[model samples]
Target: MENDREGPVPQNGSEGPVPRVGVAVFLLRGKTVLLGKRRSSLGDSTFALPGGHLEFGESFEDCAAREVKEETGLEIDKMEFLTVTNNPFLDEPKPSHYVVIFIRALLRDPQQVPQNLEPNKCDGWDWYDWNNLPNPLFWPLENMVQSGFNPFPID
Candidate 1:
């Protein structure tokens, strides 16, 4: 197959590539969802889901499970595909783009408490009411909220 994507364009001597793929796990327990205080340059100080860039050849479920375990030390029992977001941060100070896959998941052990496994990337983890998420959410998350996409929908 011919590659449709052009080569990385030079931007101030740095190569800029296409949108990277990522996964955001919505770990739900009752009416609450798990979120972490981001501590990195990108979206710093915002409360966001536990997730990261997806690796080549890995399934979305696998990426969500791995990211949840790595970021919060909790294991996901099962997950369902929620939605996909095309996030372009052209106006942000650090312009970037990501194709984010959102997944709603349940914990393998209900009693398993989350821990700050990646202190460098996140300050800590906590649960918040779905209707009242903390201030300054990551761009994709903010977009989701504005679009009225609820991770927890009653049957």
Candidate 2:
């Protein structure tokens, strides 16, 4: 396996063949959820949940909490496993793959406003009503919607 400063080099000499494991958090407040516009190469300008690659030895719940805090600067209180997705961006201009673990969580402080801690990776954060999400969602999110995976469920 070839390795680079970034990480392992894919056999195809593009990205990596190993599916990068990541965690996405759906931070909920009432009927709205928090979303950020990605600024990175993988899904630039697309609306995505706050998340990143899972660190080695980190539990999914811990990764979700950590990523939410790191990316949005908001602490999460409770988190539950929502779903998992195997996203293969073979048709994308820049092909890649990911094994994404989705987790549903609530903000530790309901009144706290999210800040963009990493502007290089994300433009900013905004709350959108679950019923009316923004267009051009990230591929995994688009798939999630098409598959009838509603993040918000009536309890």
Candidate 2 lDDT over residue span 38-149, tens digit each: 8766667889898877777999999888888887889998788998888766775556677788899998889899998888787789999988999889878877888888
Name the regions of candidate 1 deviating beyond 4 angstroms. Answer: 1-15
Q: lDDT for every model?
A: 0.80, 0.78
Q: Indicate which candidate wins on lDDT.
A: 1
Error of 1 at 6 (Å): 20
The true-versus-predicted C-alpha distance at residue 77 of model 1, in Å, is 1.5
| lDDT of predicted model 1 | 0.80
For model 2, the local distance difference test gives: 0.78
Query: Please, what are the lDDT tens digits per residue for candidate 1 over residues 1-155?
Result: 00011122344566555677778889999999999988866677888998887878999999899889888889997799998888776666556677788899999999999999888788899999999999998777887899888999577
